[model samples]
Target: MNRLADKVALITGAARGQGASEAELFAAEGARVVVADILDDPGRETARAVGGEYLHLDVSAPADWEQAAAFVRESFGRLDILVNNAGIAPPRPARFDEIDLAAHLRLFDVNVHGAFYGIRAMLPLLELGHGASVINVSSIDGLAGVGSMASYVASKHALTGLTRSIAIDLGPLGIRVNSIHPGIISTPLVQTVGPARIARLQRTVGRQPLGRMGEPQEIAAMALFLASDEASYCTGAQFTVDGGHLAGPYREPPADPDETLD
Candidate 1:
């Protein structure tokens, strides 16, 4: 529908996976997209394929965000959408007690602090636009607890909170903010969790109502909605696109076992 016609969007971590999927979809919907990522080669390739531009963005660095914001302002004059999608999910600790403090700190630095900087850096441009939206990529882990990966879960939870608070603060300025809680999608990061770990994840998926993982495009579709005018009233909301992973109770009692089967 060209919902994003004449809009300019900046998507971080757009080299591959969900970020890349969103970039492609946004461009197709008539938004001029800027693919930003630390991975130079793939970022450029993906941007080229989508007929967009690629910028080297290290989300962990505040200075990088400043430069990126300036680049967008000079190039596009205004920014209508910002997607904080760059993140890392390190391997699960051998045990909860084995969690490395340094690793946890680094995770928060990227997942939490990076989003903070992105929002701050783009505020000027976003406010300049008639209406703008910020889409933060959170995870289902942010909503629930698991046996391992406490640190990663903690970071996502923080991001979700940040998203809500920002939405509250920015809504008056016509800038909407929202978080997306994605369940296990087929991404390289998930593959790196190893076969045994993947088996455990599969068991979790089997119990979900949909009995499978989600696709990147599915998440992108929700993102597009949130970024478009269709979601004009959807700020500070957490949308889950997890193949029913967040939906409660897939099992039902043996129906009418004691009653007559009509």
Candidate 2:
């Protein structure tokens, strides 16, 4: 079904990984997708693959947003869906005190401020949209605190709050806003942690009920639902696709003492 037929979508960080997956999925669903990112080559490639357009957008830069807004306005006349999926993830988590204050703020620049910029810049277009929706790609860290990764966690939390506030603010205009929190997914960001860190991360997530990472497509599916008219009443909500990671601690069942003879 063409859930997004005739809708116009702009997805940030669509150069690769989750953003790329979202771009592909949106295009397949009949939306005129615009793959936006700072990565020039892959951004263009993703757009080409989807038979859509591309723009060089640095989410952390206000000026870039201005330009992006202009471009989208000129190209599509209005925006239907905006996915703030661009963000940075460190290979390893940083302890609270060990976290560099400035570096942490930079993480906020992208992870948090990026979403802020996207919504503000695209507000006009969204206001003129048919069934406008905003999807902020936060992480599981946004919902719960982690031992390390202080900066990343904080940024995601800020984003989550931003999502709720924006949803309420935009609701009057019929624009829906929501957040997507993903679990340890098998994305390029996950692969960059090196073999040792990868193994450690795997063990860390082993206790989750699903006992495995999620796929980018899984996250895309959730975003698609919100973007479509099916979610007309859904807003200011937190959707988790974390393989039951936020379902609380998973405890193994006790071993059976009797040998089964029956």
Candidate 3:
């Protein structure tokens, strides 16, 4: 019941979806949770429900990270876990050549640089805590190519790289950095891509081994395990909760043999 007893956790994009699930689960397991997000009203509600603090943090802004550092330092004195889960999905499905540079950079600003800023800004407090862990939420796109989500795929790959590099840097300091690659999680982020995109996603996911979309809480459970002492030796690794999407392309179910007598 007390997997994270007495810990302090700060999670970005905690107002809703996977972030919200992580916050609620972290609080339930005894971490003093801090919900950080640009969504003020819902963020506050999440914090209240979890018995945590809500900080309005725009992850793309360095100034906002500075404020978050100060708030964490003042409010908790140290932080045991940091979940850099705040990220933007592809603004629109565009082929690599057709994507606008500025639009692509905008996704990188939040999806890539947001994690970079959060890790840099929170390093001190993380070093101050016991068994500190950093969880960067990447995606299935990070591991492989997607036709139209070039920018998003690139950003997630950058984040994955960051996780690996920083793990080595922080290992000596007793901090572990790892990335989570989630596939087709049912979140508002995905919902924003519109009905047609969603239907396409559903059809695609349906062909995978699990044949279903993942839930936010399921991702949160992986976050919980990494945040806890259970994953002490784990660092600079990619944990994929992808429902076998990466296992292989879908194939028709072959019929069983007509006779088996062994």
Candidate 4:
């Protein structure tokens, strides 16, 4: 129950979904948690439920990062974990040749730049703590190719690269960085992509070996492991909890050659 005893964690996008799940788990594990998000009502409610604090944070803004980190410092005196979980996955570009450059830039600003700011802002404080961990919420698309989500994939790929680079640079400081790639999680963000899209995703996921979409708590469990000493030897690694979606093709059903096999 006290796996994260004495640790303080600041998680972005903690108003709901995987972010909220991680906040709940971290708090349950005995860490003081700070739930940061732009959704005031839900964020505050989540914090209250978990006995944590809520901070208004817009991840794309460097000033917001600075302010949130400062608040964490004042409230907790030190930071031991930072979960960069805030992001948006907009609809795929309308046509192959008609990529929305502006949308792509905005996606990167939040998915990639947000994590960068979070890490940079918390570096000093993290350095002071013992065995600090930085967990960036990426996606399976980051590691694999999906025809429709070019820009989203690119942003996640960049996040993965950033995680590896920081892991190398911060190893000496005792701060570990890693990325989690969640696939087909059930969240409001998924619903925002529309019913047809969600149905397609469900069908595609059903073909997976696990044959089901992942729950937010499943991802939260992995995040907690990475943040705790249980994963002390892990760093700069990409963890995929994608219901066997990446496990390659399934074996075709055997033919009825059974007629010959007496």
Worst 10 residues of 3 by lDDT: 253-262
Residues 41-89, candidate 3, lDDT per residue (tens digit)? 9999999999999999999999999999999999989999999999887
lDDT values for all models: 0.90, 0.90, 0.93, 0.91
Least lDDT summed over 10 consecutive residues: which range in candidate 1? 253-262
Query: Which residue runs does candidate 3 get wrong by more than 4 Å?
Result: 253-262
User: In candidate 1, which residue ranges exceed 4 Å CA deviation?
Assistant: 250-262
Candidate that scores best on lDDT: 3
Error of 2 at 117 (Å): 1.0
Cα-based lDDT at residue 50, candidate 4: 96
Reference-based lDDT, residue 262, model 3? 32
> Model 1, 127-154: lDDT tens per residue?
9875799999999988998666888889
lDDT per residue (tens digit) for residues 17-99 in model 2: 88899889999999999999999999999999999998999999999999999999999899999999999975467788988
Model 1 TM-score? 0.93
lDDT of 4: 0.91
Winner of 1 and 3 under TM-score: 3
Stretches off by above 4 angstroms in model 4 are 250-262
Report backbone clashes per prediction.
0, 0, 0, 0
Tens digits of per-residue lDDT, candidate 4, 94-139, equal 5535778888899999999999999999998999876999999999
